[model samples]
Target: MKKESKNIKKNKIVDQFEFDEFQKWKIEKEKERIKTHVPTIYGYARVSTEEQHLEPQIKQLKNSGAKKIYQEKWTGTTTKRPIFEKLISLLLSGDTLMVTKLDRFARNTQEALTTVEDLNKRGIKINILNMGYFDDSPNGKLMFTMFSAFAQFEHDLIVSRTQEGKAYAKKYDPHYKDGRPKKFTEEQVELAWELRKQGNTYKMINRKTGISIKTLQRRFNELKLKDSE
Candidate 1:
């Protein structure tokens, strides 16, 4: 009789427990937690020079649901970007880093490969809008490798073309001068030289003519060499 009473009490509790309702509550709570804990999405935009604008890239990233965005104006050949560094430091596991394209971030294959590998190791995701998710799979890795090689090739070709054009100009153009135009004219140099000859120091000349010491030194060397010749 005592055992029968114990079984009745257990059945009563089981019948009232509502297992389906309990499971639904547990699942809903889990979904809420995941939603709250999702990683932040960040976007990065860069332009090599002031001539290139970043507004379009910024708009696209914003449309992609990026919470924070970083803007940088720097050449891709250099790795010392302050804004890029700051963005890298802020990234955490599960966070995604988005860029408009790959070339905006890296100039060569080695840099591209190394940087992607590093981000992979840190559990950070990279999204290239032009391509897809960088393709971390075996086939994806092969694709990235090929893409890197092509990017490097294109950069090398550009450099070669620029150099070839410059060389041709130098050979054919009688009045071709190298590099940028001189900031100081012949008259300015002569005035600076006269000031120097009259005991005015480089500092004094710089103050009066706004020409740098290095420029003065170069002009003086050219004049001295011409005299000797």
Candidate 2:
């Protein structure tokens, strides 16, 4: 009975030692993971119009471990987005640019492909959360190219449909005007002309009349035709 009790105690001590060793090993593995897997993720969020929601996108980025985030209240069609420009300026090699979806990055395929190619050239990476794609490999590049082409096709189709609708409306409606109406009334234009004749600066006229400097200048040019007499 004494021998059996002694053996059981020895086994318990051995088991405890193994458990302590395992805990130490797990701690070291976790430290290694923290050191080696630190990703420099940059999040980008875009809204097509002022009325759209940005909270969901921001939350998703935060949940995804994004280290930095950029946002813009602009359409995806234009490549001149302020946040996008700022992101490009800050990007370094091995950094990842993350977006919620492909459409959030660009509306047109050419722009999307061109932007991706430029980033790849600079050794920057791209990640689209919805598409399950990353642009750090050749296969990923090819997939992105295909996806961009599809997005471009979708954008073109939407534009074409909008143009068709506008054309139909113009053909059927007699009061349809294709472009923007004049911003100023005849009285405003006349006042702008008089201000210019008095040698008033464009800024001065703009401040006094609540007219934009560009509008004041345009009106001044139009009134010059009458003044030539």
Candidate 3:
């Protein structure tokens, strides 16, 4: 007799306030008074670049009772965060927003102030881990303002250091390339030109060297015209 094996599947209930750690903590503290209608806690996490990571922030947010999370890998120099924007649109009154840090939420001082102001007006509670909750109270507003200023200063310093490092590299390292490194080398370009001169079509050269036809044509023209393109 052939025996059939059964596949086991795991299903965990989604955290919806009552199932969350922070909410559970609150419930434990005030078991007699804790209500079932707690506000939803949403987490927004962001890293400045693609090279950066989001796990640590997410872990903290989950531990802090965030039922749902939105994350983004993008530059913080601009106020255009698509994920954050979407999160904001979904938030209603009496909801709580959680951030691992203040800088991950806002880029500049003005942006930070305006965003927090709007959230405060909407009766949303913002919990910044490094700093405490942001509120409409005088002290809370002051703290947020200070944190926003520091974040802006840090961003400025980073930009200054990056530019200075680039300038120094250009002055000292003759082989240093600015911006992203070149995909194809000068030797490759010369070989491509040779292939072109031998009546090889752009498509043929591209197939052989794994370079795009547009790139091969551009390099061939640049080599022939002696241009710095």
Residue-by-residue lDDT tens digits, candidate 2, 1-229: 9999999999999999999999999989867765675558899999998889888998998898778889889975465788788888767667888889888887766777778888888888887888865564789878888888887788789989989988998999998878667877989889777887899988888889899987777777777776797
Q: How accurate locally, in lDDT, is each candidate?
A: 0.86, 0.82, 0.85
Whose lDDT is higher: candidate 1's or candidate 2's? Answer: 1
Per residue, candidate 3 scores C-alpha lDDT tens digits across 46-163 of 9988988899999999999999999999886665889999999767778999999888878788888888999999999999988878999999889888889988898899899999
Tell me model 2's lDDT, rounded to 2 decimals.
0.82
Candidate 3 segments whose C-alpha is farther than 4 A from its true place: 1-38, 183-229
lDDT of 1 by residue, 106-158 (tens): 77788888888888888888888887687466886788788889878988899
State which candidate, 1 or 3, has the greater TM-score.
3
- Which candidate would rank higher by TM-score, 2 or 3? 3
Best by TM-score: 3
How many collisions between residues are there in candidate 3? 0
RMSD of each: 18.0, 20.2, 13.8
Ranking by lDDT: 1, 3, 2
Q: What lDDT does candidate 2 reach at residue 167?
A: 99
The per-residue C-alpha lDDT of model 2 at residue 30 equals 69
The residue ranges of model 1 lying beyond 4 angstroms of the native Cα positions read 1-37, 180-229
Residue 216, model 1, lDDT: 94
- For candidate 3, the TM-score is 0.65
